[model samples]
Target: MDNAGSNQDKGNGKYAGKFPKIAQQTRLLNILVIFAVIYTLYLAKSLLVPLFFSAFVALLLSPLVAFARKLFIPRTLSAGALIVLLVAPFTFLGIELAEPAERWMQSLPKIAAEISKEIEEISSNIDAYATPPAEPVEKERSFFSWFGDDEKSPELSPPQDNTNSVTDKIKQSGIDIGLTLFGNAPFLLAQVLACIVLIFFLLVFGPNLFNVFVRDFPIVTNKRRTLVLVDQIQRELSSYIVTISIINSCLGLATAGVFYYLGIDDALLWGALVALMNFVPYLGGVASCVVLLVVGLVQFGLTSSAFLPAGLFLVLNIIESQLITPAVLGRSMQLNPLIIIIWIAITGWLWGVVGVLLAVPILMCFKIILENLGVFDHWIRLLESK
Candidate 1:
């Protein structure tokens, strides 16, 4: 009897131990399933990128189709006309900007040389103001020096003398310029194709498709609310794009005027660049300023003169951020600066400029979806009240 009791007790202990092992296995299985799903998504990531962009473009261009239909044109015909209209304007702008941009690129070397000299003068002026940096430094190497020749890739190292290695310069510049132009090319090409394909389909058949997609959605009292949410998102994003375009164009014009007055070469190019780039958030403005400063230095052979363009930028940036945007855009759709910066960095890191460009809209889409699902309503309410 005692032996039987002992065996029973041992069996119970073993079973309890097995239960924990089973739970652990279950947890691991769940984790693996999640990872598997992520991996699958990663594989299909290529397809998703283009389709996502196409959907966004479709959303933006939807109103035009609706307007065309209102004018008594067939919806399909309206969409086709709108697409051609968009393409023509887009191409025309590119062609107009090309020659000036080429001229600016060719003159970059001279501007860089100018900036190096002005930096030294600025240091002296700072000393005169009694606000000198703790470290006495002079002759900050111009940005152009960082890009080494093709024979050797520039090695990135902090130059003791404050001049970055030419190799380091090349690498960093490539990241800033090349990836956006080239890395995104494949995705952009795919996106363009998808847009062309979908635009016609949507124009001819969007009504049916939208109806089908919505048919199986949860039949709840909130269907109307859900639709309103979608309409609100579409309007907000479209308005945002239009507003941003206007603001950027103004900034570009202002940049051109300022630089031309300062006798900067290729001022028109710089202005156009500024206007176009400012469409992006923090990075856009900062990059244009950097490029402008560089161009000024190369052109004027001094960084002090770079200030004329820089000053214009500062004034315009402030106007846009404080007066223009706020007065126009208001606060309802405003995003948190902290989140914006972080997401920009993350998206830029993961997928480069294309990622950064899409980040805000992507987040906004997610926010709207969450709101529709009631997942973010509480948070949004808190945000609004505060």
Candidate 2:
């Protein structure tokens, strides 16, 4: 009995010693898996980014697709027609804006020179006020300068035309931009084509595909939960996208009107930019303001008018972000600002501007899913105040 008890005790001790090691190995494995997934995502971003974009867009247009279906339209036709309808306005807008955009591009050199000159004048004025007069000192000439074979220090002349250097730099920058756009044009076209195709198929066959996914799970409860979660996600995402889109369009129109009233050039273009940037959270407002500031300075120099456009945009954006969005989205869909900012930074780092735009929507979808699953409920609570 003593021997058997001692053996059992020894076995227990051995197992206890190995448990920590086993847990450590599992943790290491999990970390490795996470890093591997991240690396793969980075590698596949070019393919995946557009896919994700299409998925979100499909979600947004799902309601319209459904409406068409209710009118007895076939799913494929409805999807195709909807995609065309969605894309056509943007296409028309681009064509409409192209000439003006080109004109702006051509004027960039002149604008840059004017801006630089204004900056220099402002700096000089600042220096005149802020800097004290320097004391005059007697300078000793070098022996070479004093020699009869006089070595004169070359007198540096102020540039006769400051625009030349600025123009050259602008031209070089334009060339670089042109080359980049030209090089990427085919690839971007292909991605857009793929995305359109994906969006169409997703819209047409989404329910069928979802049904298949649900059927793959063996447990009935699991299937039910999956359907419930998906339904909730669809509802939340669709509502959010539709509401935001309408609000942004109205905001854009209001912005364009304001800019037109203020006599800002390319008011439509600025409005379009503001509308797109507003899709992003805090950073978007700042970016729009910076663009307006630059344009304002270039157009109006250092006068009070120079700051007006930016100030107006700041106020509008503040109202939209603070009042309009909250009122529309309500407390349930509202997210913690800190979490939104952090997610934006992370997505921005991973996928650049598009990632930043998609960050909140993606986070909201994830939050909805997790909340439904009863997993990370605390996280959801922590990340959303209401």
Each model's lDDT: 0.69, 0.83
Please give, for residues 206-254, the per-residue lDDT of candidate 2 as tens digits: 8788798679755545777677777778888899888988888888889
lDDT for each residue of candidate 1 in 1-386, tens digit (9 for 90 to 100): 99999999999997988998899999999999988975664566566556666677777888788788788999777878878887887678778877776565544444444444456566557656875335533445578856846444444443335443553555455445544555666867667767688766766687566655565656544666756776787777777767767877887888788778877777777777787777567777788777766555455554477566666787788788778876877776567766777877866665555566777778667666666567758766543342
Cα lDDT, model 2, residue 69:
82
Clashes of 2: 0
CA RMSD of all predictions: 12.3, 4.5
| Model 1 error, position 221 (Å) | 9.5
Where does candidate 2 stray beyond 4 Å?
1-5, 121-183, 216-221
What is the overall TM-score of model 2 with all chains considered together? 0.84
